[model samples]
Target: MDLDQLKTFDRIARDLSFTRAAAALNVTQATVSMRMRALEDLLGTTLFHRGRQVTLTDQGMTFLPYARRILGTAQEGREALRRVERGRVTLGSLRTMVAPLITEPLLRFQEVYPGIDVVVTEGRHTQIIAMLHEREVELGIVCWPNIDPLCLDLEPLVVMRERAPLVVSAEVAERLGPRPGIEDVLAIVPQVISLFWWQVEPDQASALCRRARSSVELPVEPALRLVERGEGVGYFLDSSVREGIAAGKLKEISPPEFGELYRDTALVVRSKAVLERPMLRDFALELAKDFRCMGRVIEDRLVEDVERAA
Candidate 1:
């Protein structure tokens, strides 16, 4: 059927309610119902069961995947056309890292190369590497672990330390009185830490044993907020928490025993693929420089600001 009909069906299936689907699609409930009926007639199969509560039928269950694939293919086709009209780059990353570094640079790059399109996708560490391996995406930046067999290049980047010390709320700090051991603090505090930190030195991981009851794996922002609200402590790249630390929403809870946790950040792609596109090579170089600059800028500013306050 028509694209609109496909769109309508997808929305309905997702929400499982025509009324809600219509609202989401900016159409009337009746319009949604009518579209589904038309789609069913064209396909000669009942797509949904009509009752007090709307539900997908066996036929609808079978059609769902095909319908989604059709819609996805259409969207990709449109994006491909747009890329041809204008050069394009597809980049993938873990969402936690995207906002601070990748997003702004991509936006700025787009301004310079207005003809170039940048498509960004967010996935976890493993998924991102798999995407890169498949060449589904031109580039991906991820925490340095599980590097695939592809001839990919890597660069190291660090989070700048925050100027202001992040502090727990009065209650939290008091809950674990003076000079609480890492294990004690961890037992009670809510903490967010990167997955790679565990790969650091055992002492470093052991040090956190007191500060973290158990590892809490979450996207960076939410974890920071939880720490800010005194839900628990969070471990983030020094750079990611700069804004939060500056605003006095968070404080550094120094564990008496602590050490450096390094994550090897890299640009991943097939080495041979680079030979084909000069622009691609240029982009990779610029991206590395940008990451370095951002880290330094934040560190310099943080040190200067903290020293001035001192």
Candidate 2:
């Protein structure tokens, strides 16, 4: 099957919308439909229901994981080949962190390293972490206190503080009260944390965010969607919720005991050997500086992430 067809299928399956997938892929909706048709023909089965709200067929459900894997492998191969070609660096990023943490720095990095191409692959928090460990990508940035590996096992390249807010859809916050307290939020809110964080022990912030009667373990993108729809509450990086809060779609809810919690945003690599190149080290430094600059508030606490493995 054509790699382009598989890529189109993967995007459509994830979004369940041909138009959105086409827009994201920088293609026309007609192109998206054609690709899907070509893929279905090759498979000899219909993959999606093609409704107003697209639903995957049984054939799609059975083939989805394998298609995802195939696309992943194709990406891996492409990146591997690019690296072998010289002056190229692949960075894995948590999808939520990209717009907030690295966009500006990445643009500047591209300017300085014009010869050294930078490619960023964004996945859910856990998938990005898995890519780092699997050696599919050279580096990853993840938010901490929620999706941490406990103690420096992930090879810390840089650590900076991020303001994580316990947030709810405006409707939920309204139900809680004009200015809801922890007890009120806990009575009404339902947590929507990433599935990767399901195993994360309840940290101080968790008490406020996850004290709800109901919960969901979804990826950041979908979790944000659910929160936007007023389906649940979640602790999101302050940057992640800024626009929604600004638009009155979501609101920050301070706990009775605290106003906000900090997440240690860690920039990590697979191994020290990967950073042996001075360029990688410089790139990490650039991103760290950018993040610290963008950190909206300076709290009393400063997180000192262990840099070198002990």
Candidate 3:
């Protein structure tokens, strides 16, 4: 009938002692007894058997589970209220991967849940996964292949996919000559500006890096700019260099060692997370939405690369 009386009865049933339950509940033993008596009166049944020690009678044992369920429901309702007031969310992302993968989905989310505050932490792919394991962040936008397959508690939603193109500047291509062998191309480049990746297939890029005369790791834009200046050969997402390739600023190079290059970007959450706020779940879905070859830079560039290579 009354929540307080039900709560008291549940605690007393669990502890099997009114004095112990009262101490646990921060109430006097008299108050606990009174609430238990009121609950028993409402139910019209004797709850506990009292002889030498306190123990639940048949009716009390029957009511125990139901009381626990009610208390659980109440706790959930309270937590939901607190979530509405707090409206906080944290996301982890790689420093170089945040541009097209992160921007639009967040814009769409803000249009709907403007009151919620989103904080982002930028780190390497390994660091972001570490943040998830530590429960320092609620969600991560990461390259899926880089994540360890053995990790059991990760839930990944593939948001978008783009091609990784092995590319050289037009000047570099001219100097190296048309359709040069992989070894000749490898010899000419003094420095290879490698870009950030989740490293699902590290061997593909690492092999090239190892074979090249020298290598420097850089982010997407800087890598692209340096490659355009003919600093050396580089790998870039097709979308990142689509405009350059179309405008004759960059050229695609195919080497024998590399095969089938693509990267899947994902929104990752802990498998055990409840996602109590709709904003969190909806944002993940938004990132996962299917955006084909129209406005998306990745799709547009992929088509161009295919036609040019054809």
RMSD to truth, every model: 10.9, 13.0, 13.3
Question: Which stretches of model 1 miss by more than 4 angstroms?
Answer: 1-75, 78-82, 145-180, 187-203, 206-215, 294-310
Write the residue-wise lDDT of candidate 3 on 130-201 in tens digits.
Answer: 888887788886666454543446665444577777888898888777667668777776687777575554
TM-score of each: 0.60, 0.57, 0.60
Tell me the tens digit of each residue's lDDT in model 2 across 1-310.
8888988888988899999999999999999999999989999999999878998999999998998899889898998787767777778887667877777877778777877878789876677777776776787776553344533466665566766777778888777876666676666655545434323534655554456666667767788888878777767777788888999988887766655565566677666666556567567767767767656433212123223411
lDDT of all predictions: 0.63, 0.72, 0.73
Model 3's TM-score against the true structure: 0.60
lDDT of 1 by residue, 1-310 (tens): 9988999998988888999999999999999989999999999999988877889999999998999999999998997887767776777776656777786676666666777667788877767777777777786766554344552443222233222223454556677777766666666764635333322324555455444555566666666666767776645666676676677665556656654443445445544344255455555545655666544322222223223333
Residue 133, candidate 2: Cα error in Å is: 3.7
Model 1 RMSD in angstroms: 10.9
The lDDT-based order of candidates, best leading, equals 3, 2, 1
Task: Tell me how far the alpha carbon of residue 13 in candidate 2 is from the true structure, in angstroms, after superposition.
Answer: 32
Better TM-score candidate (1, 2): 1
Candidate 1, residue 245: how far the Cα is off, in Å: 1.8
Candidate 2 or 3, higher TM-score?
Answer: 3
